[model samples]
Target: MQKDLIKELCLTQDLIDIAGTGTASQSSTSKWSKENDAQRAVSGKEFKDFAFHTDMETNPWWQVEFEMPVAVEYIIINNRKRSPFDERASELSIVAYDNEDNEKLLHSGTMYFGSEDRGCPLIIPLKGNVSLKKLRITLLKEDYLHLSNISFLISDPLRSFGDKPVFIANRGDGLGERLRALLNSMVLAKEFDGHFIFSWPLSFSKSEFHAIDNPENVFGRDFIDSYLVTRDVLNRCEIKDLRNTMDFISCDNDDYKKIGINLDQNSLKNQIKDKNLQPKNLISEYKLAFEKINFNEGVTEAINLAKSVQLKDKVLGIHLRTGDIVYSDYRYMDRYYNKVVPFYTVESLITRYLEMGYDIVLFSLDSSACRYFKDKYGVVISNDLIPEEYDDIQRAFFDIVLMSRCTEIVGGLSGFAILSSWIGGSKISTYKKILSEEEIKSSFTHSLSENGVLSSGFISPLLKSFSIAHYLQSFKDFSSIIERIELLKKCIEIDNGNNYYRLLLALDYYKEKNFSAADGILLEAVNSTDKSNIKWLAKTKFPKITILSIYTLELEKYASQGSIVAAYVAFLSRYYYDEIDMNIAFYKDFIQKQHNNKNSIDTEFLKEIQEKVNLKAENL
Candidate 1:
């Protein structure tokens, strides 16, 4: 029943690029002002972004000094785009030091120019854990050293993550749901200056994505550990098992609820109110993301495919989602769309664009779409209608990235459609299939009976779950707990296969000290349930409930077959409450006889429990 962790965490939570906050100075500003010119490197300007120039001196350098010692994780040097000079930042040595004499060389490399152009940021990631008071970027060779728009990212200690606002992405669903969850969480985490954890969704969920039919282990550990992150980055933050200790349940979304948790500020017993947190907007964070967020081979191939097409700057990108998403005259709203929407005959819009002498690229998830546009207007159908060679996962990624290549993007009321708009710096818009007033009056509501339209309610699934959670949390008394228990029971009746809601009900019972009720849930969980859910119950709820009465005969069977915790708990229950007057020795002997007497953490823990039972007997 052991589960592998799918850990993909971002480092920029509550951390900022403190480079612009420091005072800038250079060796010599012959071409520009000494004090003012070096400031432009950190000024975050694009048009006339210029670095300080020094008089032809040995090892020309530009340095920034901070008031306090801080950890600088990333240094982005926007090198000049002008030819030959762009590669002049060849021999460079970036160092960090303080007035007390502690100094370390961060990065020493030939800051080479790669494929990315214009806003071509030469990123130097300092992978050391050392902190410094001053950061110095020096050119090793005897020449004028100039770099445009240099930005420094400060990633201070990530010690206090408990009780903070977090967008936990652990939903094991389709790629569309995963992407939408990540996108929404990214936006929310940015707005609240919080964090997002990519957990079991990638690995443990259904593999309807790349390789279908498998549900347990979709993403491999090696796949996750690939270009996504390195061991060095992984070592920085500790993974807190929220199941053991969840101090911060600040969110009220379905993302939290499906995992069996609801936010209750007043109801929480020991919610830490950390003062170190201050809400700050995610500026320059996107630039740092460009430095990080490395893609796998498939994504690289997709990007290359997009580049080959050369959908130039002014080209329009559109996501006309079909398949399960049908856009008839009567139907407009998408199932995953969070807002009220209109259905459009997209051909009319394409015709209008073609008439205006604008080239268009059409992208759709459905096969039947874009025939008229491809034939008449001769607009490029992206990926030749999502290249059949690539698998489901790659196709989705390719389509989104291809659309993102466009300067202006319009996704007409689809989650799959809207995703492309988020990849670039500026967020474009989801293309609405707006109908005229006369057309709207003439349109019938017959599409509401369709499967796709039925699924696309007024709100999103995440929000819908949140609405239920909020309803449960609003009760201010003991009735609140009772109401949650009853509500969850009813929800279980409705969604019987949803072990999460069942677990939530059981946990509510446990919280109320209703051991019998909790035992009831675990008894149900132990049989005819999913293996993961059973394993979860065996680990988290099983041991705790075993003390009540051994609960069921199933426990005895489990105890007989190498269940050390079960055997020990069965012994304790018999010794204290279940069996007639028997000494600790008798029950201990029973446990020793039933279980495979192995040396484990549970075995050691049981030894300590035996000692406690003997002491209680001696006291009696």
Candidate 2:
């Protein structure tokens, strides 16, 4: 008696045969044609009733196509329990093909056919959740292929993920350290397939900690609530259990073993000194999810300060980092950098920027450093001009905001320096060796050239204005949306066809639930052939089917043209029409472009991404 082989699993659960026409390397002369009928093997009935048989060959292969890309957890293969052919499925390889024609080797080597004495259903669990359009099984060393049944357990997103989520209890760390922790957690959440509770409380007292501003004080309360899932929310009845029961994890402990391919030994030593300071292993797919940190009142005030100070558009920003840093962390700095570079004094950096034709230089330093620069260069730091009660935390936030507005930034080795330069959106220059006038001259000579100049004023205004609009959209406050819309409209009137402004206007409409108005603007922005707009478009969830279809069509058109942003958008599209191939294409194109440009640091970053995707840099 052939006992019921399939047990434990809900054989009658929401089962569907999504397999399309199947093809094989070679067809069998038997009636079980290697065509669409191969899907019949998926039928949960007795294995003897149906099987996908193929003719004898060196390496025979059989493939099943799914109607759409489905998130698969595991696949169960039923082998014939009969005599000789029982072990036919022993050495086989399974490959999954996404819609973009990218192939992933899901399973290989020996089969999971439970032992000879007491065989169970051959279940092959996927390592991670993946979306696939087709699956192929090939005989590696075997001469024949016989597949009884191939069934997959599609993923249910609503179901809790098996592994517990992580949360961190951040101590009184510097703002940069805190931010790095947040960034690290984002990486963990993506890799581990779990949520993260941002547990850093806004209000805490630490005499040792120089800066400790509530997140709401820097980024608006409304903005933080919308984008970031706060720790306060985690304490709620519905979520508290999940937080308490789930594992408590911290990114500080993550060794970042995967981040060594791109950096040299010296650079690696500096980065790894503090785990929190390690350069983020950025995953493009997770970019939208990491958009939690945005601008707030602090940022707004920074912009107003920039304007009020009348710091010329082409100002240079310098973080000499010689205030509390020189005395408190001198040993720490010496360890990483090998020696003290004396040329990074306040007067020297200010003079350097001035020599490069910068009208002013924004200084994010202690008042002592500020006074030193003023005494020598007769230049008052921007912070000195702004009248306010400035605590260390508040001052640090102000400095960060101000630095982010700079056209170009040069700094010493510090995580805060790195953050300011990055958020400022410019080519960052750092000094590792002894900073001589010659070295400074060699670096700034290009800046002194016209080609090195960036539109100093535009980045800040664009980012700040968009931040406000994004905040309003997140809250879905109709009245605020109206005000935002008016502001964006005014910007558009001044600078027509600015995609960022247009996207903000569109989002304002989307927040107001005016899909029609939003669609009109989105359609215009999408048609412009600018890839930047695609990220914004991807963030939006259209309420109307017609608008969604239109947007998808426009996105496809751009994606086909090899726009990485469009391809990314298609990958993130809510309609689930995108495949892994789009991501592959986007990365290939992006790597090729970045590789051509000889920016060593940026190229290293690209190489890190290449390593993440298992793609060899030389191959491209």
Candidate 3:
């Protein structure tokens, strides 16, 4: 398991063709068209003799055809090594086409050069088992996409748990929250005949993170083949239940029942009420569930490392989450509103722990915050103990597990710290309000035990409103205004507390020239005749003009605090208001400032708006 345990090879030793925009000449007399070139590429050899080369083009392609439909788990591409001038396949995309000419994009990314001259292979793990008759590699950027080797791993459909309900556990949240979610989900999933596939930090996984080149390592070859990443076993396989991070976090049995699974929470609740079920403490209950599940090598290693680092009942843990929150705009509220926790005033808190006979203070913190804590208190930062070569996810996983080893914990507002405190079963003191265990219980759609034991939980009123509002607001396109209004009206019937939802409904009405209805709702939501509200009164072909304007004004006080959608809306609002001079000035400013900073703005919408405003402004 330590070595790169490549699954069984299923690639045929056939001569593939190079034919595309710039591939005609590449097929003649070149290293690409060399006899046995394609065969050598997939023959598990990374030597220059086994490489295939193509000419540079805007869009060059190399394709290989399998004799029959083969289930592809994943593909690895090793670039040719020509040393100094070796321009590796920098940015490329992989596409799979079936016999019927149906195609799907499998993976896309830059082929990063690993350590030394040996370099690293670019691994493209597909989402699930994809049966493709032909596979093609296309260069996204202008370059020759060279290949030293093309290795294919076939999927084993007969793998165990194939019959069980499958859930893809992809947590895009902070590491600690993700682990907490996984623990909760595994508990609920066990209520039904459920299995899970953990795909975290998916496309960004690197060989350096795995280190040692041993497959048995947490991120090693065997670990990846078994769990994580998207592979053929992931493709074409039937998923009885599929939930994203949010869906999994807030899912109930009703959600499952909607997907035709008859797992009912009400039955379980009735059984519990009738004393037909033995009640268990929620924490220990989930602990038992977590015990039943098997974590991948990565998680197991993290837990082991945590155990090794734990002091004998004298460790004090403190988590300072300062990276993203410091830069986060608090004025504009995002979907989930976890209260921000401050760490600057915690010196006294740590001093008390030190005086109370704690031998070690294990500080889990980001790079920016680590220095401050280390210098001020002379404590050990978790990052120093972890290998720097580990990727962000690996580092995050390790940090959380390490924090969980403490006897007592003082945490920030971060779910990372909160979840760690919970896992460690420590006396937790958090700076901000955390999600209550009652809320967690209510968030459950339904729960049932393996032996048909069931417990039903109520959905929070606010959660229900948010869920309906999210679906209704998703139809932001003008073309869907009519359908959107209908849906919003229905949502309002169920939950009318969301003023934002009402504003959306009003915008739809204004778009349809229902001035009376639009004005009524707008005034009710804001109760003002301010200049900002005038845009809502104005007629425009696109409702987004009014909709975006409304959000910008409503969240104007929270202007510094905004989501990507808010920024996008704010950009559109400027254009709709005919602020051409301001638009041009801001665009120039954006270009200048973004030279050093990441452009997190809505560039696509900006471009479209710029083109339209440029035309209109010229006439003015």
lDDT of every predicted structure (CA atoms)? 0.49, 0.48, 0.48
User: Least accurate stretch of 10 residues (summed lDDT) in model 1?
Assistant: 1-10
Best by TM-score: 3
TM-scores for all predictions? 0.34, 0.33, 0.41
Worst 10 residues of 2 by lDDT: 257-266
Error of 3 at 358 (Å): 5.1
Residue range 1-620, candidate 1, lDDT tens digits: 00000011123343334556677888887754545787876664553434566777889998887644555566666665566776767788988896465778878877675212363465666643666678788888888777766666644233234444454444444454455444444443564555554432234224332222221222333434321221122233343333332333333333332221211111011222432322233323423332244445665575567556665556766665443322221111112332222223344545556666667887754333345456656888775845577865566667766676676666644544444554553345543333443333223122123422212343233322322332333222424687678656755664454454554565567567665676567546544355424434233332234223324344444444544444444454454443423545644565566356566655674675567566666766
> Residues 176-267, candidate 3, lDDT per residue (tens digit)?
54455555545545655565445444232332221112222334444344444333233333334332222432343333322212111121
lDDT of 2 by residue, 1-620 (tens): 11232332323332222222222232343444545445556544445533667667767777766433555656777665665676777888888888678999878898646322236756666633676767888888646677666666542221222334443323334566565555444554555554443444544335333466555556665545433433322232133221222222234333222111111112222424545433353433223332455656655665456445555667677664533333332211122231111222334556667887775554544444345445556665757865586555556666765665677766655556555554455445654332564554443333223432111232223322332332333234433556678866755664444565575576556556665676567556656664334444444333332223344545445444433333333444532433334355555566566557465544554565466445433333
RMSD of 2: 22.9
Number of clashes recorded per candidate: 3, 0, 24
lDDT value, candidate 1, whole model: 0.49
After superposition, candidate 3 runs with Cα above 4 Å error:
1-61, 64-163, 201-282, 285-303, 310-315, 324-340, 351-380, 384-395, 413-415, 433-551, 554-620
Clashes of 1: 3
